[model samples]
Target: MEGNHSAHGAFILLGFSDRPHLERILFVVLLTLVGNTTIILVSRLDPHLHTPMYFFLTHLSFLDLSFTTSSIPQLLYNLAGHDKTISYAGCAVQLCLSLGLGGVECLLLAVMAYDRFVAVCKPLHYMVIMHPQLCLGLVSLAWGCGVANSLIMSPMTLWLPRCGHRKVDHFLCEMPALIRLACVNTAVVEGIAFILAVGIVLSPLAFILVSYGYIVRAVLSIQSSSGRHKVFNTCGSHLTVVSLFYGNIIYMYMQPGASASQDQGKLLTLFYNIVTPLLNPLIYTLRNKEVKGALRRLIWGNLHLRKTI
Candidate 1:
């Protein structure tokens, strides 16, 4: 392991090196990047999507894009060739960005849930309640919280002395994997991390569930079945995304152990890092009628202009 650490402070990423085939399949991360970019562009270009929901969605897409880009490109580069080493600075940036973006997503999802709750329970006041100023403030708060989490956690994790043990068992420089590298006792760090996890992960999730509970009651009170279905359709995509994002995150972070199994840890990380981002755009676009219409208009509008020329 001494050879894995360089004099200039580099860490060897031992990500799926033993399984070359799996590395090849992980290239799907490219699609994750593209999909997130499309969501950002479409949401901005379509005037019909100028509501608070799409506003939050645009931020979510940006976070996903930044989050995946921070790690996946390096992973792919390592997988593509023999060089599996990441500079100490590079690893630190990846860890910080991923942590910050992930934290933001958790809080943002809760914000979106609240937006849904207002839209459903108090339709007449939805616009007044979720005004532009409030939306911006909420998003800013989420970003601030995420940045604070990363500042608190990333530095502590990175400060641990590896003592020449620099080979990370997983693909990216995650908190749990980095913690495992410390030569000294990490019980204190682990405890702090667990506490933060509860605050950052579980708290938002509970909020989402509670918001949905109110939403459910409101839907039940609607006399028309079509109204109920419409409300469900509007929110189902968000629910699906919340389940996918939080389920994997809770299992990965909320466990007593940082990661029970290194192999399992890699797969779960890959799922959220790659698969979830890829699916988010698909889930929203396919399930959302407004987005689909906007996309069609954008496409045919361009086509018609070209034909006229």
Candidate 2:
């Protein structure tokens, strides 16, 4: 009974099911999104999408799938009245995958920005430069880079001693949450995480910014107003997506820990970790007419098939 009590005190997350009714609603909402994104990505790969833009878009969909899969299924199980807290092993797995996907996503966006620059400025060489093999290499590199980063941080993080209370206030097992639970002094671990976090974000961000600057100059060189408008529109969409991701990330990581001043850290984390990925497919589809048209055609064709059947 005493052992049982201790386990409950360290209870694997019950997740956010305290509200009961919200569980069903969130479940439907998130599941629908997951399904929609899967369909969209599958459609994007239908040979018609050999271009760099759609290639990156599909990668984004894949990232969103990974991001949600890393956390949501467990969260749903918790909502459905399963174990609330994750086992130590499960938390470690989740942390690695989640952080890896997140870090890779940061880099992938930078790659997309560079792809855009090539598409706009060096249209003649765009195909030759971003050939099938190189594009594959870039995408593969993004995944490799992300996992490498997590490999560095996750073990560094999980090795800390959890000698005290281990209840993570948030639904997901964040690095900060796990670090805070450690009974040992976490200053060193936190410092390492901080350095790694910046490493993950800053280099990719610098690349992205430089790529966009060149892209803007290239866009400006287009003497035709119509050509300028089209280029600007495409860049605008990419810019918006970049801003949404980085805004939340910079907000979350920019804190140098003195901000223990409030409970707002959890709220800020939600913006990037939970909320941003949920809305990513929507942002991409809405901004890119090609994606929107493809989705509409897909929906229409599916409906036509259902009627025929």
Candidate 3:
């Protein structure tokens, strides 16, 4: 009974509960759902998007979709009603799935950087190197590492002695928020979390930085300003995404022992979880001519189909 009580505990997620604007939260959720859905739909339907970059992008959009879906619906439920309780199993699933997606995104972005590196630096060998087999392997590696990390960490987090503190102050069953509920000293967990962050977050970040460094050198070696401009434009959207994602994550987890102000942490979480995913489709589609072309064709095709009907 004691084990059951401790292990299978419900959590009260007090996410934005203090705010007066339930409607605003709903609006954000709607926007996120729409954005993620649009990216996935367009990527899948448009043959013009059948390249390696778009392949990774579609996966990223899907990742964002699953990541946001895992938590936001429940958040909407809580924000709309009086009840904010999440079952122990549900919370554990949320933690595992969300973390896995996040970790995947981190590694996926790095993989994307390597793709860009190859495309820019080794234009002649780009196709040969970034073949279907290699692309698949890289994506699988990213996903495998992410799920493996989450499986290791989530259960450990759920098993921590909470001493009956069931209220999670954040909107989700995040590792940091869950750890905060622990009655005992989490020095070891924090240390391990930092190490995991280094592996999952910082190591990939370093690789991205190094890859981009080479990319920049390659881009600059081109004598024509127009040539350099084209290369930079291709890389810009990805760099923005990397900055948005890694910056917030590194800040949050790099120092696991340091407790961020709850309000600040919540705001950062909101930016990455809801806002960043929402912006991804907009960023890639708006900046890339191919995506815009695909969107146009998809829209016209749908219209033509309707007219025929």
Q: By TM-score, who's the top model here?
A: 1
Score candidate 3 by TM-score against the native.
0.94
lDDT of 2 by residue, 105-192 (tens): 8889988998898989899999999998888899899899899978987887676665456677667776666666566677776677
lDDT of 1 by residue, 53-111 (tens): 99999999998888788898899888778999999899999889977988999999999
Give me the overall lDDT of model 2. 0.71
Q: What is the C-alpha lDDT of each candidate?
A: 0.88, 0.71, 0.85
Clashes of each: 0, 5, 0
List residue ranges in candidate 1 displaced over 4 A: 1-8, 256-259
User: Largest lDDT belongs to which candidate?
Assistant: 1
Point out the worst 10-residue segment of candidate 2 by lDDT. Answer: 2-11
Error of 1 at 117 (Å): 0.3
Write model 3 residue lDDT over 60-94, tens digit each, in one string.
98888887788887887876789989999889999
Candidate 3 local distance difference test against the native: 0.85
* Candidate 2 segments exceeding 4 Å error: 1-25, 28-32, 35-45, 254-262, 300-309
Clashing pairs for predicted structure model 3, backbone only: none
